[model samples]
Target: MSSTEDTTAQSSIFKDCLARRVIAQPALSDTPDASSSSSSGSDLDEFISYLASEVWETLPSQLRALTHEHPVIDVDADALSLATIPGSFTDTLVSYGIAADPDSACDFLRSVLRDYVDEARAPPPAWSSTRTSECEICERDVPLTYHHLIPRSTHTKVLKRKWHPESLLNSVAWLCRPCHSAVHGIATNEELAREYYTIELLLTREDIQKWKKYASKQRWGVRRG
Candidate 1:
């Protein structure tokens, strides 16, 4: 078999082995071994740092330009807060890449945070209906246009790698027209612009679902009276 085919076969086998092991494990809520835990944590940090660096490198030139315009602050502390937490970043990393092991991935992320704490800056605020009028890129009120946090180009580039549509949307943001133009370029490329709109439509579905849940809660609340 070809090298690619061989690799795929091996990966499938490994995944099957892991699944079986998980099924076999007894429920253990007790504390884990300290040394093993620490070692695993360290591995996670290394993996996170590697992944973050890859992401940074993969960003579009326009997006990178914006970051360059802004000052870089220590990100280690914030990274720790985001990385250690059992949510978005951790989930994204694991889903995007087949981590060697889960515990090791977690630990490596922590160490990565520690190393880059000083270099990290707070991300720009998210854009929503309330924030749409404001420019996300420049924080000004200039006919803001939604900018994809993860550009369509980037998404397409990474599509070959394992990633879900929902995870892709979670990684993007909205920006103003000028800022969007500035980041992308002055030429109005209709096709490229359309891709962004498509992603927005996908994200809208999420908003609608949230609204539906909220409305259900409100209706239930009223019915309880």
Candidate 2:
């Protein structure tokens, strides 16, 4: 038996699915898996395939041809743009009859990809050094993030306290991750500084409560347009 024959005999029966193709990795430790490009809510591969498939509509001859060659391929964040939509992708879209203007479809894909990239790159929000990890307002056992009671942008005019490095962190409120994002979404920095600066004051706002309720329904960070 030759080397090729020996290798084929030894290799585990190959499966068409991704789990078979990917090198079995240890469960991610302390960080998310960066190797896979797929995202939970928005699937890039399926979207492209759907556009090319006959199930949606008949694609143009050119796009249909591309389906066989580049059915699904991984694209990086930098390549997610109107200018960068590969020829194969454009062909696939046209073949599926989904391309009214190829540029329009490309723009939509870019926006969706940009959203995913933003999520992947987002840094964890920081909390005030003075406060414990637990939220000061909701008292939930969640990740803590700092809330600027006076809003850091106010620093442009004058310092809220003595200008130590931790001065801003020291002066801020300790809030749960949800609450911190909620507070900023509802009220502008000026409003937060002038009107709602304390737990009692912030908790009473109807907007904050509404935001909290809205956030609870979302699967991730916050529901955005």
Candidate 3:
């Protein structure tokens, strides 16, 4: 077999073996190891980081199934894997306000998750269409637009997950002109689909907040990230 084929075969075997091992083993949760809990602070941090990465990695599949949009995106990726979609990823990243470089995309996605936890503790104000509302992130009273937690571009991924897609379409937040522009400026459609799509998640990014604050105060112009 070719090298690529050989690698695929090996991966399949590895997964199968892992499945068999899991099937034969007792649940670790039921027999927790004391040493596991007693791990060093650095070790704990590493594990938590790994866990978050894994969650983002697998989120697209979940989104496809849950959102129930049609033509479900069959490609595999998470926020960290945005570089995989090179041409489109780079284009969208630049349009969204972030630098269109592999290093920049990877670095941004890696650190964005921690912001979500902070958002949970102190949520931003929800966007309203009927009444004037400040930008949720910058607190600027600029005109706001509906920002999808899952970009409309990702409706296909949603179709993959859900039996119905209406709920996903209905879910969105409001962002002021500059903040909204900034969001699209910093992240790609795939990245938004997989992570950093929610209002709370967005609020936690101090870097984005800095952008918003600067934009809100600047009369001349709002710069993209």
Candidate 4:
């Protein structure tokens, strides 16, 4: 098949996979016996095979080269941006309404190829020794911790009660240790999940701002009270 035909087939299968997951049905993994005479099943398997082999060649060469070296698709911010920006295979797909945007594309691809991708496309907002990054809150050049916007502790209850969408469960903020402590100190997990999920929303509080200002000045390794 041609590249466009291959991409269109892949996108359709991917969308079907996503829809099946949403409604709690088996998607791509279902197989049909040769005697079953299920054309749709046979076609799906063909597209899946194409995905395993030829899909990489359909992508932008830079992205293809990048993923070729890594066992898992590491979709950092820049890579995610390329999905919506001009001149990318994902952009073309988005233009055709195959997915909403980068986030949606990531979700669709992740769901469709669950084993090949990480659980989450974005890295957890924590910092480490060799790859330390600045805190999202205090902007401190310190070790950071991953603060789940909707605390994992509350996920079951939240979903059970239909309090929030499943997508928000994995949303996160990268904070320095003290700032991280101050956030949980000021609000309950439920409150954080509902009202203070975003950094912009969290920064609106005087207490959090005060904490940021104070914590930003402190050197690394200073613990919060």
- Which candidate gets the maximum lDDT versus the true structure? 4
CA deviation > 4 Å runs, candidate 1 = 1-132, 162-166, 186-225
lDDT (Cα) of model 3: 0.44
User: In candidate 1, where is summed lDDT lowest over 10 consecutive residues?
Assistant: 216-225
Candidate 1, residues 1-225, lDDT tens digits: the string is 454543333332222222222112232111122124223333333333334544443323322232212565343333334334455444544554433445544654444332222112223334332453544433444333456654556555445543445465435445543234333432233333334334344334322222222122211100000
Better of 1 and 2 by lDDT: 2
Candidate 4 lDDT, 129-202, residue by residue in tens: 44368898879776677788888898998899887899888998877644665677678988987788889999
Per-candidate TM-scores read: 0.22, 0.37, 0.37, 0.41
| Candidate 2 residue spans exceeding 4 A from truth | 1-120, 125-132, 156-170, 213-225
In model 2, how large is the Cα lDDT of residue 143? 53
Q: After superposition, how far is residue 184 of candidate 3 from its true place, in Å?
A: 0.7
- Every model's Cα RMSD, please? 20.0, 17.0, 19.6, 18.5
Q: Which tens-of-lDDT digit does each residue in 1-225 have in candidate 2?
A: 453442232121111011111111122111122123333312322332333332112222222122212333233423345554556655654554444467855754443333323332335443333334556655654456667787777555334443333444336777765456456655677777666766778878754543333233323222111
Tell me how far the alpha carbon of residue 26 in candidate 2 is from the true structure, in angstroms, after superposition: 47
Of the pair 1 and 3, which is ahead by TM-score? 3
For model 3, what is the error of residue 132's alpha carbon versus the real structure, in angstroms, after optimal superposition?
2.1
Q: Which 10 successive residues of model 2 have the least lDDT summed?
A: 12-21
lDDT of each: 0.35, 0.41, 0.44, 0.51
Of candidates 3 and 2, the better by lDDT: 3
